[model samples]
Target: MFEQFFPNGMLHYLAGGLLIGAGVSFIFLMTGLVSGTSTFFSSAWSYFSTLPFFRQKSFLESRQWRLAFALGLALGGFAFLLTLGNGQAASTGVQWWRLLAGGALAGFGARMAGGCTSGHGICGLSSLQLPSLAAVITFLTTAIITAHAVQLAGVLP
Candidate 1:
């Protein structure tokens, strides 16, 4: 029983989670920026937008760099899909539409909530802010309820 559950394993996950927490804590301590997923995506979007040449450059113009970047993102996405597919065998599975919808929802939610989960939960908690604590509690509580509701509605089955 222990071997079955621990095959891919728990130690690595615990270590990785600790490292990520430490890194997020360090980021808050040093830069005061939230180590949230939305913040990272926003920063990446900003960086990519500033690089106009990346958009203008054709595949032939910057063949190697373009190919490498595209391949890297594709492989990363593919791996994520594979993991999700394996873990949630009964689900409808990954879809591009779901990605787009999720992105839009996250962007809207981040704006409305005043901060994304990372900004409020990790950074805000690290900074010992009362508002962030409240936000995190509300966010998590709502998430749990919403997840349950969705499952009950057969939206995620």
Candidate 2:
């Protein structure tokens, strides 16, 4: 007894989307901050750690709230995977170095784009910005091309 149009737990996707929307909206409402994890994470190093990167400004300030927000995002994701996902997801069969390389490339891409998926796809789109629209389109197109290329190259399962 399942829905014809929504087979294989389609409701779960809807629920997840609603939760994301609510969470982002709540963050903006309560803190007047966009729920952009990438920026928060990049800025988080200043609060609990010190680095020469601060030389440009020669300043030290606190952004503990950003740290908390980033933590909450991580915890929420882990919780979801642990609970609803039964702590299981498909493996990419990639080695640690490969994963690190992928992450580095993604970070580079985000930097060039001035934001990550969360900033562009979620918050910026919600604000109905044309730049966000373009960014999202580029992100999706790149993802699709990369996925197909990887599959064709037999690099992933």
The lDDT leader among the candidates is 2
Candidate 2: C-alpha RMSD after superposition: 4.0
* Cα RMSD for candidates in order: 9.1, 4.0
Which tens-of-lDDT digit does each residue in 20-136 have in candidate 1?
688666655776544445433333343357565334433234344334444554675566568855644344565676568867887878756756776687667867999989999
lDDT of 2 by residue, 1-157 (tens): 5577676768778898999999999988897877666655456556556676632241233255667777898789888789987988635667676589868888778756867888899888989999989999998999899878977987754
**Model 1, residue pairs in steric clash:** none
lDDT of each: 0.62, 0.75
Could you estimate the TM-score for every candidate?
Answer: 0.53, 0.77
lDDT for predicted candidate 2 compared with the true structure? 0.75
Predict model 1's lDDT versus the native: 0.62
RMSD versus native structure for model 1 = 9.1
